[model samples]
Target: MNISWEEIELYLRHTFVTARESKKNVKRVIVKLEDDGFYGLGEAAPSPRYSESVETVKNFLNEFNKLISENMSLYTTLQMLNNLNGNYSAKSAVDIALYDLHTKKLNLPLWQYFGLTSDKIINTSFTIGIDTTENIERKLDEAHEFKVLKIKLGCEDDIKIIQTIRRYTDKPLRIDVNEGWKNLNKAIELIKYLEDNNIELIEQPLPSEMLYENNRLREQTTIPIFADENCKTFEDLILVKDYFDGINIKLSKCGGIFNAYLMIQVARYLNLKIMLGCMIESSIGISAAAQLASMVDYIDLDGNLLINNDPYTGVICKEGELKLINEPGIGVMKIEK
Candidate 1:
């Protein structure tokens, strides 16, 4: 097998601002694995909050290449990769590549290989990043095919943002605060207000450290609260199960598909809802996440949809629904530049 990676710039269609940072262009690392005249692709979109960068991912991949030799079994390769701590995004790139390679070798679509039925897949929400009301309206117009919208909030004008979007469309809304809110009382009040406005869910309202506050908020409100920053690994699930109604599993945060699969099972065992999400990535990454869509109650794999320049062709998003092809592996092809 041969391994290599390169950095690519992902240009967002609009300025995307969270409480943490604002981004117009994000840097991602694309990893490629090749063996026996077949190629598998993966992506690593690192987050600063997670302390992962292109440099770190590249270094980890370099070390990973040194540890593996020819004819290694996929299970052993995955186990060896799992043993290396941190760099979840890096691990995700490798994990996805391996899955793509393995599934292609078996000539089965990833979802089918995982025993998931196509009808079980749900609609994905298009994101409306933090922006002016005028820009928000434009973004909404651009997202006409999306029946669900995920809004970025946590600013002083958060309520106004919801009100502005309400005037345009009645689509079910999901709000992500990115750990922006600090006050529990205010968070509860805001959540109630959002619920009244047809908001389906609220994500990461408070910082990860405020587990007690999150639990109190969850108890006080009827709306489902999802843990984003609060839940990174499987162990964090125990701390959040009492507080959050569900967990948003990002491959970058949990190390990749292998761990993400485990996280979904554990969440199901605990009777918690599951949402598969992604960072600002290309089609390669989004396609990888989409493979696990049928296992979750909700899908937020619209990262690639929000971007203008996606260098790969993978999942098909139409009429707010996510559709996967019957092609083998992750079922994505590179778009010629």
Candidate 2:
């Protein structure tokens, strides 16, 4: 096997805002692996929240290339990734590409490779990033095709943001605080206030390190509290199950499909709801994540949908439902940008 990668910037349709920061564009690295007339592709959309950047992803890929052998098997590659210290997002690219290439060799789609039926796939939630009341309305209008909306909260006027959204549409709402709410009492109060507003769930309301505070908040709220930043690997699931009602598993954060598949099995055994989420990515990343959609309880693979300049075509979202192509591997095809 051989590996090569390049960095590209993805522009958002609107300025993407979360509790932590705002961005109009995000940088990502596209990795390609080829062997004897077969080719596979992957993406690394590293998040600053996880201490990863384009430079870090590229550095890891360079080291991985030196370590990977041409005749390495898929399982061997995965084991090598497992032994790697950190850089889960960087490992994810190799994992995704290996899966894509291997599954294609087997002439199987990734979902079929997992023994999952296509009908088991569910609708993915479209995200509405934090903005002014006016911009929020505009964002809602743009997201009209999606049946469910995930709103970004954590500002001073958290309740007001929901209220503002409510005034425009009655669509089912899910809120992600992105670890913005710090005060346990205030978080409890906010969840209590949102109980009647048709909220489906709340994500990472408190800080990531505040496990006890999150557990306390969960004990007091009717809405399911999901762990995002706090839950990364299979081990975190065991710990977070005691605090959170669910976990948001990201392929990049968890080191891609191999790791995420293991995490899903453990999450189900722990009786924790699974929400497959994504960073701001292109179709390659989104499609790779969508392959596991049938196994998760909820889907948030709208990272590709939020982007205006996606260089590849893979899984597509139609009215909130991710439509996976019947083609082999992760079903991604690069197009002229």
Query: Total clashing residue pairs per candidate?
Result: 0, 1
Top model number, lDDT = 2
| Candidate 2: residue 222 Cα off by (Å) | 1.0
Worst 10 residues of 1 by lDDT: 113-122
Off by over 4 Å in 1: none
TM-score of 2: 0.98
In the range 1-337, model 1's lDDT, one tens digit per residue, is 8999999999988889987789899999999999888888989989889888999999999999999887987899999999998999999999999999989999999888889866664799998888898998899999998888999998888989999998999989989999999898899888888768887888999999998888888887888999999899888988888889999999988888888999999999998999899999999999988988988888999999888899999889889899987899999998887
Model 1 whole-model lDDT (C-alpha atoms): 0.90
Clashing pairs in 1: none
Number of clashes in model 2?
1
